[model samples]
Target: MKNMVYGAILALQFLTRFPLPVNCSMDHNTLKWALRFYPFAGLAIGGTLYLIYNLLNGLLPLYMLTLILLTLWVFLSGGLHLDGVMDVADAVGSNGSTEKKIEILKDSRVGSFAVLSVIFLLLWKSVLLYAVLDSSENELFIIAIPMMARFQALLQLFVFHPFQNKGMAHYWKQHLSMRDVIIAACWVLPFAITQVTLIILFSLQICFSFIFGKWAVRQFQGVNGDTVGASIEGAELWNLAVLYSLFLFGIV
Candidate 1:
């Protein structure tokens, strides 16, 4: 129980920019166990955005609030996943040898492909969120999307071997006995079962992760930290698109 609580705090610290009041140990053992709390960390981030939306919904124009929410989302995550999107975009756009692509992914310099991808992704996400906000007053979409997205991320972490540094993945596979991932899924499964839409989303997330995982393996022969980050951002976009489509058809 104590480790689970520390794991949750460690997850938030690693996953977001939120200021925490207490300090905790960050050893590899703690971090590997902390993987179970990633989805809840996402929920905390999304829940904060939901709270802000309620507080400012009427005071600010919908468009303004939409931008504010988007901005806050980026700030909260410290653009961690966005960095992944940029790196992977640059790598895939390079279309070079596997070694070359991996090298490019590790490069800190941004490329034209990185710039274009981030612009397109953020633009589409903003447009989608604006539509969802205007069409419905539901808080579940915002709160649930991030939670599911992080579960999607956990899928990457749990399922793939690291293409570069293999330490974390190696330790997790060795020590946790895979129950840690089950615990993470347990955090999400209850909420996913509450809605048929969520169940569909969960299934889709699994399918997408497998497909993406294969592609990553074929491309670099395995996954990297940036690639994991790419999966997280991509999952969020998928969630937003699915939700918006459901809303457009008056299904959710």
Candidate 2:
């Protein structure tokens, strides 16, 4: 329960400038420990965003609200993971071997591919949110999406080996176990039962992680933090695309 609280606080930290009592002190299971309860962070982000969406629903135009929500989200995290999404996109598009690929990802200069990818993701997400808001006023679904996205991230922590480097992923890789996986599954499963649509979205996200992570491993020799971020970002957008497409075509 304490860990879950930390996780919620951590999520708030990611989404906003809330100060946390705990520091990233590199303690035992600090990274893995922090991430183990990370899904709760999603709950926080989703809840806060839902509130904002409701508060601004009639006060602002749909596009403006969409932009404000996304901009606030990015600002909250200082665009940390999104930057990873951009870097990974740039590296994947470039002609390079594994070593060269990592070098390209590490380069601070943004490429055209990176810019294009981020723009598409932001725009796509904005549109998706707007559509969903139009159809459903229940803000819980908004919260659920980020919660599920973080849950998808947990799978990579358990399933894939990160490329060699000392970072948060390394910490998670070392201390994470099946017991942890079971625990996380327990928390997320009940939520899954609440909506068939959620079940499909959750299942789709898991499928993407294996296929996407495997592709990253094959192409880059192993997964890295940037690749993981890209996977999360991609999975969220892909899930949104599928859901919205179904709505657009009246399929589901």
Candidate achieving the largest lDDT: 1
Each model's TM-score?
Answer: 0.92, 0.88
Best by TM-score: 1
The window of 10 residues in a row where model 1 has the poorest summed lDDT is: 168-177
* Candidate 2 colliding pairs: none
| Residue 160, candidate 2: C-alpha displacement in angstroms | 0.9
lDDT of 1 by residue, 1-252 (tens): 667678888889878888987687766567766788888888898999999999998999999999999999999999999999999999999989999998998899999999999999999999988987888655666877788888777777677777766544444434443677788888778778887777777788788888887888898888777787788888888877887787788776
Could you give me the TM-score of model 2 versus the true structure?
Answer: 0.88
Query: What's the distance in Å from true for residue 4, model 2?
Result: 6.0
What 10-residue stretch in candidate 2 is worst by lDDT?
Answer: 23-32
Per-residue lDDT over 1-252 for candidate 2, one digit per residue giving the tens place of the 0 to 100 score: 555455445545643454576644444444444566556666666677878888998999887888888877666556777988999989888978888888898788999999999998998888887786666534556777766777777788679888876765665678778776666666567776687667777788788889988988887777877887777677767777766765677655
- For each of the candidates, the C-alpha root-mean-square deviation to the true structure, in angstroms, is 2.0, 2.5
Model 2 clash tally? 0
